[model samples]
Target: MAVCLQLTTSNSSMCLCQTFTTHLFLPILYSAMFLTGLAGNVLSLWIFMAKISGKSPTHIYLINLGISNLLLCITMPFIAVYYALGTSWSSRSLMCRLAINVLTPVLHTNIGVGMIILAWLALSRCATLVQHSHGPRPSKCIKILPKVFFSRLRQTPFALGVCMGTWAIVATASIPSVVVYSMKETEVVEDGDKQTCYSVAVEVGGSGSQAFAVIGIVIFFLCLLVVLCAYMAVIRHFYRSRKSTVISDRQRVYARVFRNIVVIQIVLVVCLLPYHIYKAIFINLAQTDSGGNGTECHSLSTYVEIKNVLLCLAALRCSTDPIMYFLLDKTFKKHTLNLIRGRSNTQDSHSSRTECGQSAPYNNSSPKGAATHDTHSHSKD
Candidate 1:
């Protein structure tokens, strides 16, 4: 009888552990991710608009990436609140389904788009650097790619069509998950207590759904791998061509930007790889019906924990992106500083004017000086 009671207690404990890991711990992890990501992406968006606007194709891509990250972050708080209140989702079924569906595509597309942009940036660097060394002024090549891409990007209808096409691809890739996984209510009975609530779950689709999920995962991984390879090649080529020195500040800035891109790519890989791998394993286990046993339960718990950790790492990307901008884009840093100083000077001038009944002369020597003076006076008003 004592042995029987012990066995029963152990089983209950295991169930509780699994529930807590999935419902409580994972929610908290996602909450942190949401807050961090939202703050970071919003900042990136602002910086892009206010500081980096109309600069380069890379900047345009970065703006899009920021928007995607922001959208994902917005959904995370809902997920966190759902899990925090109880291990159950209290939200409406439709909302749960929409939330889950929206996140997958946003995440998948953001990663893909970001990687593609990085690859383009690297390839552009390689081409421009190679040409500059072989022929006319190196600086001329910097303007050439931007002139070409920007001209193409400027046709409003064409730009819209391109955006639509890219989004269509992402939507197509994500539709399978939306169709196969949806919100459903499940009943949980612990001891004599019973509760029912809605939660996200995979729908009853045979092998087809499983295969589709795998394919989506594979596509993302392939894109990541390709980006990694391209950056590695770029770095190697740069290293080999030591004779082609970065003579000017502009060249130096470009070199630094390339380095930052490499760093960002590395960070993305480190954070995202573990989550995908664990998710792949979890899906495999679920498909095989191997998750019902004790060993599999423990494995699931560990994977959940690992996923939480990865999510935290992924959140770093949002905050880290601003740092990359600061490092890579000297113009952004200068503009930021000018804005700050302009505000400070304006405040000082306002105080002086209030005390002495006279306004300061507007300095219009340099373009930045004129801009700063105007900004300062505007702030005072």
Candidate 2:
């Protein structure tokens, strides 16, 4: 009878938790995240393609990053809907598994690729600075590394290769979870009066899953550290340089880009830390067989709630990325202005000619011949 009472209480608590999460928190959080991520990522994609498409090699990498984030954001609505419908996978089991599995790899690859690209951009800028300090001429050795790596990168189709490689890694990592956790039909009975179908089951985490999660966390932290280091180097370089060099338009633009990147990195670290810590702790707790269930269960519940909130914050990164691109990239702004203006090449040329005509006389005429030369110079010049 005592065991039965304990089981009943556990069930009640779980039901209450589920109701609170599904009805109250999940709907609001998921909807907001989905909409924000979708709008941000889509805008980022448009801005990159429309404005920064032909700017530089570095912009190519950034455009790809935006594309990856856009793809990930597109998946958010499905996730939101699933949670909003009481955490039940109403979609086909295959889709649920595939979506979950794909999401992990896409996220992992996106961060990895973004960090790698950002590092290259920083390194490229640093190399340019060093070369400029030396002289206008670039040494043969200085040119070799970029030529070799970029040539190789160009030869290999990066987008297709990255997509395939990422999917493979994610699929391989998710295999254990797929095998260990089979969807089981569960009926929640409330007050002996209400019943609803839900998918629930026990998932046994194997060495592989644990290892994958650990490696992912390590990759994330390593990238964060590298980016921080690179930013510090950049800051130092800016400060040490002459004020005139630092205040140039090019330098200012790069500074804004660096600032945005730093903000994004900080957000990434803050949002991901709680999730990683919770995962580590929860995994350890699950492996222990202590029958002191109540305390463990409560702790798990709290961690889960915290994890959900952190996940929402992490999702916000997708939406904010586009805004960063818009704010930081002057080329994007110029392109947008051009598109809005929709002036033809002919019209631009005509305007240029008119402005030149207005200024030509003032430039050509001497003080004594000002009036007389003005009329003649306008026709001749």
Candidate 3:
């Protein structure tokens, strides 16, 4: 399960002092992520709906990605408010549950789903390129390979179904976190008036928390491996196929898609990998200290601080995705520019017509047929 900073100590009260993390840094970081993620995802969703009709698998995946980020972004401000209130939910247990239990897990779910989709997209492009280079059909002997089995991920309905399944998996996985998360009262210092509010559930040692953290880390690593393999295969294919006499329009589109995959992988490495690594380490340390054998609260505090910083880094993924969409997707870019210039629908229509005329020979729309290297269709949105 995704965790918020453990802001209160269970046994310490004599030297109680305000931590800079829960009071200041977290609030500031969450606020910035909230605003930036909100704007980016909203624009991304608008561009998708206006210019791309979910006709392509990538389009569908990105649309869902945008939605996930948007929802996650909405939760950020509430978290900021929570931290801004000195780590107190002010008796609002439901809000605390909603933020830490529901939204945090959803953020984790988004990362998993996005990474899988991106990796799938990369692998699909590589497979299609290979198919185009070799022959129209795969041999019966190797048709059952995982790559071949998932080749249809590029289809709209198939992608949608996979997305729905991803959400279901995420929801099921988060149930334990929701059930275990609850508010606990912290002791007041000498001359204290009221008890401080903090959640005490599963700060370190809970079967559910440990299980979820381990599972999340495992999922992240698996997805990372998939992404790395897809990238390597695509790069290898490009290297070997460079000497081909004729390059189809489909291959050119594949090249562009591969570049997008590369960028997304880079972003994932920067924004996500460190956090998961730290998460695993943090969980392990907590498990080790669960026995209460000379545990160091200062060390735990430092780890919690580092973990929160890493969480913020992971949150940057939501903000960066719309940037990825604008940078990598030509259709999205064109539509964004048009929107900025206050262009009329009629002008946009004209621009789309012009784009259709000069595009690559193969129609990139209809991802299922793209593998055959058909040149009749327009570029994918």
Candidate 4:
């Protein structure tokens, strides 16, 4: 009787939570994120393509990241609809499958590509700084490492290879999730009224979901550790160099670059970490409590609510990444400003030309006649 009562209460809370999230909270959040992310990423793409002729490895990685984020943004409305409609959605099973498969793989792909590219970016930035530094006295082997590895990476073909490899590896790893996820009617908030698209592994009531969550957490931490170490090495190099009496312009430029890289990484962590941490805990507890293992449903409801909110927060990363580009990359900022300025200038020039033609059509079409008229008037005078 106690278990029954607890289950009932949990169900009621779940319904309320779902209603709130689907009706008001998520639509506003998703819409804002989608629009902002789309605009920022589109602008980023334009700058990368039009304003920049030569592409560095870091730039290439950033472009790829922008593309990934744009793809993620494109899927936001589909996700919003899924949550908002609950199980009442009348979409075909194929639409449900397409939405699940496309969204899940893209999310994983975004994370995978971002992590790999960021690590590469740090390495590439450090290599450039070391190459340009005047007071660097590393041993031959140590110095040669960046040249042999990262210098080659700066080449366009090599960067393309890296991007392609990243896509291939991430897609291969994400295939399992794509295959396992299916659309099923779940009785979480209603009597067979609420349909959910979820992983088959999740439905089997085993440790699979928990195991996957642990693996994801481990991968996330591993990449984060790599990024931190790489940036720390860069920072330490600059810090030690500060002891020198005279710092060159090159070193100052490196310092600015390092600051930008640090800010970008900080943004990345702030946007994504909470979601992963909360997800790991939620999966662990939810899986443990799946088989009537003496857990209160109220606590489970709270976990569900927390996880949903965190997931929404994770979506904010897409919007924040372009902001990072604007703040960090001087070239990107300059180009973006120029692009905006150029567009306005073109419009102004076009409007002036149009008005001039309308007001004095003969100025352009009959220059000889105007000159002849002036000559005749001079003769008359």
Candidate closest to the true structure, highest lDDT: 3
Candidate number with the higher lDDT (2 or 4): 4
Q: List candidate 1 stretches off by more than 4 Å.
A: 1-29, 90-164, 183-208, 244-258, 294-299, 337-381
Count of backbone collisions in candidate 1: 0
Q: What order do you get sorting by TM-score, best first?
A: 3, 4, 1, 2
> Candidate 1, residues 161-207: lDDT per residue as tens digits?
55455656776766665565432212223353222122112211235
Instruction: Give the TM-scores of the predictions, in the order they appear.
Output: 0.64, 0.63, 0.79, 0.75
The per-residue C-alpha lDDT of model 3 at residue 111 equals 72
- Report model 1's TM-score to 2 decimal places: 0.64
lDDT of 2 by residue, 1-381 (tens): 000101233333332134465445665776676677677666556655543322333445556666666666766665565455433442244445554446544554554555445444444444333333322244443455565543333222543354455546654765554443332222123454322212222122345555656666676566566656655654555444424343354454345545655665565577655666666665666456333445313223344455555656656666666665555544444444554689675654554445335433222224323322222221110
Residue-wise C-alpha lDDT for candidate 3, range 1-381, written one tens digit per residue: 122333334553221123677668888988988888899899998777665432456567677888888877887887677656534453344565465556666666677777666666655554545544433344332344565455575466887887788778877867765555432212124233222233233234355666767887898888888878766765665555544535465466556655666687789899989999989998878666533324322336556667767887887889988887778766778888998999998888776666545433334454435443322121221
What is the lDDT for 374 in model 3?
23
Task: Please give the ranking of all candidate structures by lDDT, highest first, separated by commas.
Answer: 3, 4, 1, 2
lDDT of 4 by residue, 1-381 (tens): 111111133334222224365445776788788999999999988767655544545568778888888988898877677555534442335555565557656766676677676666666555544433334454242454655775564456777788888888877876654454432222123343333332122222235434655676787777777777766765666665555526354345545656676676777688778878877777767666543323533335445556667777877887888887776655566566756676675654454344334322113245343333222111100
RMSD of each: 9.8, 11.5, 5.6, 14.2
Global lDDT of model 1: 0.48
